[model samples]
Target chain A: MFKIFDHTADIGIEAFGETLEEAFEETARGMFAIITDGSKIEKKEKRKIEIPFEGDEEILLVDWLSELIYIHDVETLVFGDFDVKINDVLTAYAYGEKYDRNKHKYGVEIKAVTYHMLEIKRNKKGVTIKVLFDI
Target chain B: MWNGPLIKIDEYRYKIPESYKGKGNNLKMRVPAIIYASEEMLPSIKKDDAPEQTANVATLPGIIEKSMAMPDIHWGYGFPIGGVAATDAEEGVISPGGVGFDINCGVRLVRTNLSIEDLDRKKIKELVDELFRNVPSGVGSKAKVRLNMSQLEDVLHMGAKWAIENGYGWEEDLEYLEENGCMEIADASHVSEKAKERGKSQVGSLGAGNHFLEIQKVAEVFDKDSAKVYGIKEGQIVVMIHTGSRGCGHQICTDHLRVLENAVKKYNISLPDRQLACAPVKSREGENYFKAMACAANFAWANRQMIVHWVRQSFENVLKMSAEEIGMHIVYDVCHNIAKLEEHEVNGKKMMMYVHRKGATRSFGKSRKEIPSKYRNVGQPVLIPGDMGTESYLLRGTDEAEETFGSTCHGAGRVMSRAEAKRRWRGQEIARNLERKGIYAHAASWSVMAEENPDAYKDVSQVVNSAHGAGLSLKVARMIPLGVVKG
Candidate 1:
């Protein structure tokens, strides 16, 4: 599950899950929450993106968010929902829309996903993570 | 974190209360952390969360005086951008965070005889193209001139001297470089084989993002005497080289971070930030890191030297002038991220301390023996680069800088995050926009261009103004970018 906060420019997503995969989905949702007002972006624009990491699970999470950020920058698309599966690596099929400058009131721009404040823990309940975006 | 009130020392200076001191923070800090900034710059400093970083640095073992922040302060990994702190030599700890990922990421100025009158759109474009071609750039970019293990060791030890010996630049250029473009204490033996492997082929490359080569013209002369001393004249053309040791430096930092991280536990050193992991200066770990870091610093100086050599060659080829006729010479080379062992007066006694300047420049004022004889009277030339579209500044160290441990702001600090700048700006449009302003833009990637857009940084004029007001560096000559090459 994920809770979204109204940050000035970027949406802040707080996610909790019983597994790393669930927490990652919430993180993706957080990124989308800031891209478009939840009310504006319907789950209409859907696409599949499966990202493979060269390193471990922690770096995989960063790479996953970095991929979405890259897609946002290169394709000019915004996603609202995320369904991610972590089997050895992360594979995600997400939903979003083409960024309409006229319609989307841009929030804070996150430059690069930093390792600062990045944590993924394997607790008794499951895995918990907190990542901050540099806006 | 300190829970006490922030005591205002002056309009530009403030202190964190003693009540904020945390356990495991040693060194008997003489005063609370101090930061220099105008009213407007303070908000960005706070918003960037650099103040807490400053407080965190104060918690380092053997920290002395006060943890300080410059006017251009912003959030960096372990230390705040423009953070400066010194620790007792025999006991103080050295952190890789104090240096940064881009070890020896610095700026160098190349003075030229050609003026604005000699450069038009076509000529400038031709020059930029030549520079981009001759100078290898971009991320994961390989060097055109490869070096084997032996050659790499020479570079690690000899630094810019190796470049000069290999016919990269003239001997006279060495005089203008910090430590003569080579730090003498550098020990390649201390550097790991993996770091050497990474550095072997990466010399003379510009690498990527924020690293650039810009063709600029002298736009304004603030201190004519200092400008003249620096061989900069009004309207003269110049090439500004901004880069570091590239992969070598990055790998060096990475390698050291691991060593220091483990050292933290081995040495039983307590630090507030994991990124600020360190070991005592006299300890085996500290000496090892210093020696290796010096090698990295040397490699960085050599990297810039090779780039400068190519820049000279590019000018000669494009302008159809011999190197002599082009009259290109190095004005200065200065380092921003490093920690060096030096002796400074503390409590009426001279004490050896390890000065860690993360995003700060060593601005030793006049009379220091380390300064070149030519600049000994006016102090060392401090190069401060603005963004591509805005103006860069040339400054001289002020006497007050010596009081602050020979430190000064490095550049116009980033104001907007890269993502924000990209969202508001189109890379192609920004490139075209520079063209309209009579400036040229050549970048390896759109992301790089957008990240380095002039708007992403604060107004350089204000940054310089604050530096002057803070008594760090005196403005000399301002440079305007004519043609820009970004990686």
Candidate 2:
């Protein structure tokens, strides 16, 4: 599950899941939802993204979202769902379609993911993380 | 309320003494934190974390004199918007947060000989509509001018000079630009391939958010001499373009920030917030970020210059007049978000410092030789734009601004969140109200219109008054928008 929070000049996201991978996926979904309605984005295309990590989960999270932003900009894709796997390297399979202004309802443009108040933690129930975006 | 210890220095100045440090687990600060705001503006400013952000800035290493926030301060990521801090060039640090994501996000004003009496409401509406078509705006707006890899690299290095070389603007336009529209330190080699890819097609686009192209009329002149020097007369028409480097700058900042995040650990720099990640000024990471940042700044200068050309074309198309006949010439351009190596007197000794102005303008007084020869006797032109339906001001820098490293307010700071503004006002209602007031607004969507309601911002007139009263900048003229095209 994921939820959006209000920031005075930007936006924030809080995602929770049964595992870190699930949390990452939820966060990705939440970020896309902020850009446009996720329900409207069809999973007609799939792209794979891999990011190498050195055990810093916080930086890894930022990289994950940044990759998605780059893909969105270059390929004009609006992702609706994400399947992520975490290990020494994290891999994500993003599913969505090209953004069509007439079909996609536009929201605030997310410029980049920020480290402001960025966090990732695990407890008995699940893992939860919060992130802020510069818009 | 801030809940922090604040000392009233004067009616327009407040200080959080260096002894105050911070609340709870915050670090000790090297300098005091000063904020320029009148008592009337304090309540709105205190409602957010801007004051805390300003105080946190004081904790940065080698911060000289004081960490300061202008009268238009607002809560922003890492550094508070409208914040200014200068650090020792040899021993201090450099942070991307100090410059914000939109590198060199600035404003440019152009004056025309045409007066309001010469334009009818129908002609004004047609001109605005033409501009809306000419300028690519809104979210993900692509540019009509696409550059190849080599041409894109040229833009990163040459800035507005490249635009003029390509017939995008007049040769004399470069004189009125800050830094001649190109910082010498810009190295395209340091900018990433991804940044170039994003920039190639975004050179002439007016990116979304507060970015806009507006037609305004000089409504009032406070200083006849200064206004005359700026070539702005009451009731004369003028154009203002507000934008930055677009996605390219955003990507560059993002890429460098990751490197700096690791650099912080390598350099063992401690900070109260992770968003304040930085590296020593002389470090490899720091220099690389500066180089890439300079490239982005150049890109922004070129971007605005291209838009100026388009605006000129739009006016000519609608009015059937030549550029010379229209008397459209640049008044001045100023960067609001940037970090530059500048010389200033610190402790009575002239020294070079890395002055970081996140959402502040460089308000150099008359003594500075960097200003154009045309207005050297007066000072740098400080352009402060208001919201879509409010009044903007043109001010001249003052020698007193040397106390704050020659910086002043950027715009009418936001008092409400986009969500809050959207909740409070409907887009249609806001548009209707602006239309009723004779201001034609062409926004991409109603939500954008509502999110940028003039009421959602602090009164710009009051903000300018506070800055003028504090002697940071002196008022020259006031402008009210006749039409606005927002992204």
Candidate 3:
């Protein structure tokens, strides 16, 4: 599950999953939801990304989102779904196609992923993550 | 949320003494923090964690004097949006958060002899549409011109000079830009291949979120002599472009911020926020980030230069007059988000300092060689762009601005979030509202119209008036928009 939260001058995302990886994926979905304004983005193209993971999970989360933002800015692609695996390294397949402003409904631009109030909390039931974007 | 001790110093000044942070934490600030604001703005100023960020900035090592904020302050990443801080050249540190993600995110104003009487409402709409077609804007917009890696490097180095040399603009245009649109210290070699790849196609495009191109008319003139010196008069048409270094700057900030975040551990520096990452100016990491950041700053200058060229073309195409014939000359350009090495007098002794202005404009008074020679007697022109459907200001810098290190407010700082603004107003309704106000508007996405509804921002006139009252900058003239093209 994922949800969007608001700040006075910025916005953030809160996501939840049974595992840490699931939570990261849900957070990515939450970010794209802001980009596409919750419009349907078909998985016509698939792009793979790899990250040399660091020991710090928080830094890894920022790196993950930053890498995605780089791809979106350069390739003009928006993803609705992401498949992921994590060990000592992170590799993922992001599923989406070139963003069509008419079809996808253009939304806010995410300049960079910020570490402000970033979190990864694990409760007995599930894992939850929160992140903010500097738009 | 940030309920801290805010001592009212005067009608336009407030202070947060160094003792407010208390003695409990290891991150004791070295100096006090001062904010320039009016009494009426205190409630909304304290409405967020902005003042807390202002105080956090005071903790940086080697920060000189007081960490200051302009009246348009708002909660931003590591620093408040309208924050200004100067540090000793030898002992200080440079933080990407102080410079912002969009390095050299600045404003450029173009003046024309044409007046409101020369064009009717239909012509204004046509010109606005022409600009929308000529300029690539909105989320993830690409530039019209493609550059190879070698060419992009020259752009990263030469800035607006490269654009003018490549036939993008006129030869005389360089004189009006801050730093002549190029920082000679810029070394593109420090920029990453990833940043280069991102910048390869996005040079001239205007990115989304509060960035725009507006066709405005001089609505008011407060100082006749200064306005005359700047060649601005009531009823005259002028164009203003608001944008910055796009993806290239963001990547540079992100890349360096990561290294600096680690440098904090390497150098054993303690800070309140991870985002306020920095390294000493003398350190290898700090030097490299500054050089790479200079490249991004140059990139933004070239980006604005190219847009100015196209803006001229769009005007010519619509008005059927050569740009030169229209007397469309640049007034002046200023970078609100940047860190520059400058010389200032401190306690009767001159010292070099790196002045970081995040969402702030330099308000240098008369006789500063850093400004253009044409206006040496009148001081530099400071451009403050208001939100859409509001009145933007043309102000003059004053030596009195030295109180804030010669810096002033940037614009109408955000009082509400985009999400809330979108939730409250529909895009179509906002467009209709603008039409009722006789303003022609176009956006890449209508949803952006709702997201940037004019009501979402503080009254820019109020902010400008505070700056004027505080003696940071003096009001010269005001410009109201007739047509707007939003990214």
Candidate 4:
């Protein structure tokens, strides 16, 4: 599950799941929700994403979201879902198609994923992750 | 969250002494920090973590004078939205956060001979729709012009000159822009291929979020002499373009930030926040980032120049008059987010320093050689745009602003979050309200209208008055939007 929070000038997302990987996937959904309503996006095509571990889980999470933002900006694709596997490296598959402005609707165009107030937490309940975007 | 000591320094100034080392840090502040705000504005300025961020900026190594923030201060990453910092050229460090993600995210104002009397409500709507059609905007907005890798490199190097040479605008327009629309230090090779790819098709486009093109009428004139010299008169029509380098600039900032983050550890430099990632100004990493940043800045200049061309075309198409015949001329363009290396006087001594202005404006006073020769006696024109359904102001730089390294406020600044605004207002209702106010607005997304609800922002007049009271910038004229195109 995911919820959106905000600051005075920007917005952020917090996601939770039974596992860290699931939390990552939910966080990706929260980001897409900010971009659009997220229901119209279909898994028309799949792009395999691989990111080498950057030393820590915090940096890795940022890399994951940034990679998606980069892909969204350059390729004009919007992903509503993601399948992930995390080990020494992060391997994932993003599912979406070329964005149709009329069909999908317009939300904020995020400039980049910011590291400010980024967090990853684990407890008895599960795992929760939070991140903010520079709009 | 930051309840640190703030000593009142007269009416428009507050000082955070150097003794406050912040909450947690081994790095000591090299210089004191000052925020130019009225006594009544303190609560909101301290509402978020912005003041702490301002304090964090003071801790940067080799910082010269005081780390300053304008009256429009708000929370931002690394530096407050209206933060300004200057550091010694040789020994100080340069941070990517200080420049913000949108490098050269700036404003450009163009004037026309036509006034409100010449344009009716119907005419305003037609022209606004024409502009919306001509200028690509909103999510996934693509440019009308496309360039291959080689041609894109020329744009990175030439900036607005590339646009003018390509028949996008008038050649004389260059004279009125800050830095003449090109940073000669820009090297295309320093920019990464990904950033170039993102930029290639995005040129001549306006990205979403607070970026807009507006047709406004001069509503009030404060200093008639300065207003006349700047080619602005009460009741005259004008166009203001607010946008930046788009994805190209974002990618460049992100890539460089990663490098600077690593360099922080390598250089053994200590910073209170990791986002303030930087390297010594003379280091290879710092030089490379500066060159690449200049490319992004040039891209933004070229982007604005192309939009200006489209704006002219849109007006011509709607009114059946050539732009030149309509007397459409650029007044001045100012950058809001950038790090520039220039010479300024420090305590009565002249020295070169790197001035970082994030969400701030460069307000060089009269007699500065950097300004256009035409406005030498009155000083450079500073464009301060207001939020939707609000009044924007035109101000002039004051020599007194030198205390803050010759800078002033960028905008009214956000007083609330986008989500809060979105939750409270309906876009369609906001549009209806804007129409009632005699302002016609066309937006790509209804949701954006709600997010940009005028109430979400501070009262611009108060912010402008604070700057005027402080003598950071002097009021020239005020403009109220007649029509707006939002992305």
Candidate 5:
């Protein structure tokens, strides 16, 4: 599950899941949801994504979201679902199709994911992550 | 939100002493944090985290004097929007957060021969419509000029000079631009392919979210001599372009931030916020980020130059007059978000420092060699843009700005969040309301119009008044919007 929060000059997102990978996947969804209504995105195409990582969960999460932002900008793709696997490195499949302005509506354009107050906590319930974006 | 102790320095200044401890981490600031504001503006300023952010900035290593916030200060990610800090070049560190994501995000004013009386209401409306059609604005707006990879590199290095060589703008425009529109340290190699790809097709596009192209008329002139030097006359027409490097700068900042995030650990630098990730100025990582940042800054200058060219074309097409005949000339361009290496006097000794101005304009006083020769006697022209329907000011830099490292407020800072503004007002309603006030507004989307309602910001008049009272910058002229186009 994921939710959006109001920032004075920007936007914030919080994602939760039972596992780290699940939380990463949900975070991806949450970011896309900010761009457009998630229901409009059809998972017609699948693109494999691989990120080499050996760092704290917070840095890895930022890396994951940044890669998604790049894909969204360069390939004009709006991803709705993510199949993420994590271990020594990250390898996943992003499912979405080309963005159609006629079909997809956009909210505020997020410039970049910021590290301000970025936190990832895993407790008795689950793993949760909070991040901010420069709009 | 900011409950820290603040000592009133004067009617226009307040000081958070160096002994004050920040909210989080309880770090003792290395220097004091000073804010420039009038007594009336303090209530709204205290409603946000501007004071906390300012105090946090003072804790950064090698910060000179004090961490400063202008009257327009508001809550931002790491540093307050209207924050300014100068760090030692040899021992200080450079933080990307201090520069913001939109590198060199700034504003420039262009003077025209025509006055309000020269154009009828119908003509003004037609001109605005033509401009809206000519300039690609709003979200996902692509540029008409698509640059190849090699040509894009030239823009990274040459900045506005590249545009001039390509016949986009006049050569004389460079003199009026900050840093002559190019930083010599910019290196294309430091920029990533992803950043380049995102910027390739966005060269001249006006971005969304507070960025705008407005037609304005000089409504009041406070200083006759300074206004004359700025080529301003009461009721004269002018155009203000507000935007930056767009996606390219955003990606550049994002890419470097990851590097600096690791650098912070490597250098063992402690911080109250991760967003303030930084590296020593002399470190390799810091040098690379600075180089890459310079490229983004140069790209923004080129982007604005190209947009100005298109704006001139739109005017020519609508009025059936050549640009030269229209007397369109750049007054000055100011970068509100940037970090620059400059020489300043410290304790009576001249020293080089990296000055980071997130949402503050450089206000060099009269006789400063950095200002344009044409207006050297009057000082640098500071452009402070207000909200959509509010009044913008043209000011002259004052010598007292030296105390603040030559900086002043950038705009009428936000008082309401975008989400809150959107909830309170409808874009269509806001546009209609502006029309009722005789201000024609054309926006890519109604939501954008609503998000940028004038009521969402503080009164620009009061902000400028604070700056003037503090002797940071002196008001020369005030302008009211005639027509505006936003993306």
Candidate 6:
């Protein structure tokens, strides 16, 4: 499932999902889609990163985004994909990377993520995450 | 949730009707609700559900005139973040959330003789480091000033005056403080012993979450005359202490909210939000809460006073100069989260009313005798602090402020929630990033650091701009943060 929604003044995100891993991937694609038009970027580089959290879903979610924020700040990279695997003990191994401005065009700058509408609801078939961003 | 009538007042102001009576709205609202904002800001205001909160506040038992919101309005728990409502003294109701959990959470301005250029970046860095060490910060941070039960009561009742008598601050400082550093009616007996104990050792300490001790340099002066009168100049160093009554205030609000929640049903007062639970001003519950909340407010004033003393000490210890030699003096202190009894024009008659300002500051204009004599001619100085990386502002109340019950926006209200900020950013790296930007942040924990990130707040410039644009306040000077010590 993929959907685009307006968050605030100048931000729009496209939420995507097929699997749990696919959902995380979709969140990043959605973020870049909001930040810049990600359709312009070709799949240039694939980077691998591992994130460990206490065996809790909430902390896992926090750690995942903290990692992304670190990458964005330090390397000025906006990842377009999230291929996450939740292994034993709630560890998440994810791979993705830098969104080239030349390759990917986007819209309003996302200052930060907010917990206003944050949720990860699990149904019989799968899970869905609702997140709000500050633009 | 209720959309009452939209009463068009003027270009910059509008009102919501008082017709939503007996429908969970509490006020016997005599007048419509008033909101100040531009067309651009209105969408965000509506998004936060602020209008509903304002309308709900308007429905309070004895609310006088409109439940007012400033241009920087945003959605907040019970009362909208920038909401202000004044109710008749005998019939008005008081709610904890209206004053917030942090009672008397306020801002104080301090001026120094030295210009910003006199303190090199290295000196400023040292000053900030010293402040971080000297002023205990973060969650549950203790203070050097320990007090017994009796001494705690003294602080509670005396407020900043207690600090002065104890040699923590100077007597002259009292003049610059709101209520002379004391709210006279704060009965120590009204404050629970538990609240007293929690506050006993917390004085002179900076509490956590959006609370800070900042060193700022004035960068712009918008009103030359007012700036001169305020002793503010371009490149001048000033300190802004922003915190509140800490655990004492929080416990007081918690305790009272429980009491009010029970009494509201007894009083047959209906409210849209339980957070808006209140009791009539004449009721015992209401009186007790007011006295107790006043004690908390005084405790907060004392807390900030003691912190200001330590801030001076930090400057003295780090700079190797006596505080007297450095000419460190408080400019003014103003409370944001509070409800106070004041006289206002109600139905063409001067009536005593309980003014509830949750995330709003008093912006009394010139000629309001309540303002200090020094500023009586220029209006009260309204201090608005921005984020760690940006500039804060010094504004003065304008004559137009009377239309909004002498109120203004408190600070750059949060744009992001804590959980979301933590999710989006790493504390350690964020600290490092700030360092690269020539800004240093000393926080007790990362949890708090992420919550108070610059992006977590609205553009304070926009907030101040809206305030000035609306004539509620006039900008005096802009101060850029030199360093931040957060708790």
Among these predicted structures, which one has the highest DockQ? 3
Docking class of 1: incorrect
Give all candidates' CA lDDT scores: 0.78, 0.91, 0.92, 0.92, 0.91, 0.75
How far out, in Å, is residue B480 in model 1? 0.9
How do these models rank on DockQ, best leading? 3, 4, 2, 5, 1, 6
For model 4, residues A1-135, the per-residue Cα lDDT tens digits are 999999888999999988888999999989988998798999997989999986788778888888888888888899988999998899999999888878898668989888888899999999999998888
lDDT (Cα, tens digit) per residue for candidate 4, span B70-113: 99999998899999999899999999999999999999999999
- Whichever of 4 and 5 has more lDDT, that candidate is 4
List model 1 lDDT by residue over B407-484, tens digit each.
888988876765566678878888989999999988876656776788888787877788888888888888999999
Error of 3 at B457 (Å): 0.4
Candidate 2: give the clashing pairs. none
Residue-wise C-alpha lDDT for candidate 5, range B134-246, written one tens digit per residue = 88886667788889999999999999999999999998999999999999999989999999998898888897889999999999999999999989999999999999999
lDDT (10s digit) by residue, model 3, range B437-479: 9999999998899888999999998899899999999999999
DockQ of each: 0.07, 0.65, 0.83, 0.81, 0.61, 0.02
The residue pairs in collision within model 3 are none
Candidate 1 residue pairs in clash (backbone atoms < 3 Å): A9-A107, A9-A108, A10-A108, A111-B419, B2-B20, B209-B487
**Residues B1-487, candidate 6, lDDT per residue (tens digit)?**
3344556566567777777453444545556788876656665566556787787787678877778987767776578778898888987787776887778989999999989768887998899999998888753367877888888888878888888888888889999887887888888777776577677778777766678888988988988999988888898999999988877786677667767867988999877666787899989999999999989888888888888888899999888999988889899999989999987775568778888998898898997888889888899899888887787899999778877778888888766555577568877888888888777777766655665678877888878888887788989999988788987
> In model 1, which regions exceed 4 Å deviation?
A1-115, A123-135, B1-4, B21-30
Cα lDDT for residue B24, model 4? 68
The residue-level lDDT of candidate 4 at B83 comes to 95
Model 5 Cα lDDT, one tens digit per residue, A1-135? 999887778778899999999999998999988776777999998888888888678888888998888878777688999999998889999999877656775445778988888889999989999988877
- Where's the lowest-lDDT run of ten residues in candidate 3 chain B? B20-29
Residue A14 lDDT in candidate 4: 96
Q: Which ten residues in a row have the lowest lDDT in candidate 4 chain B?
A: B21-30
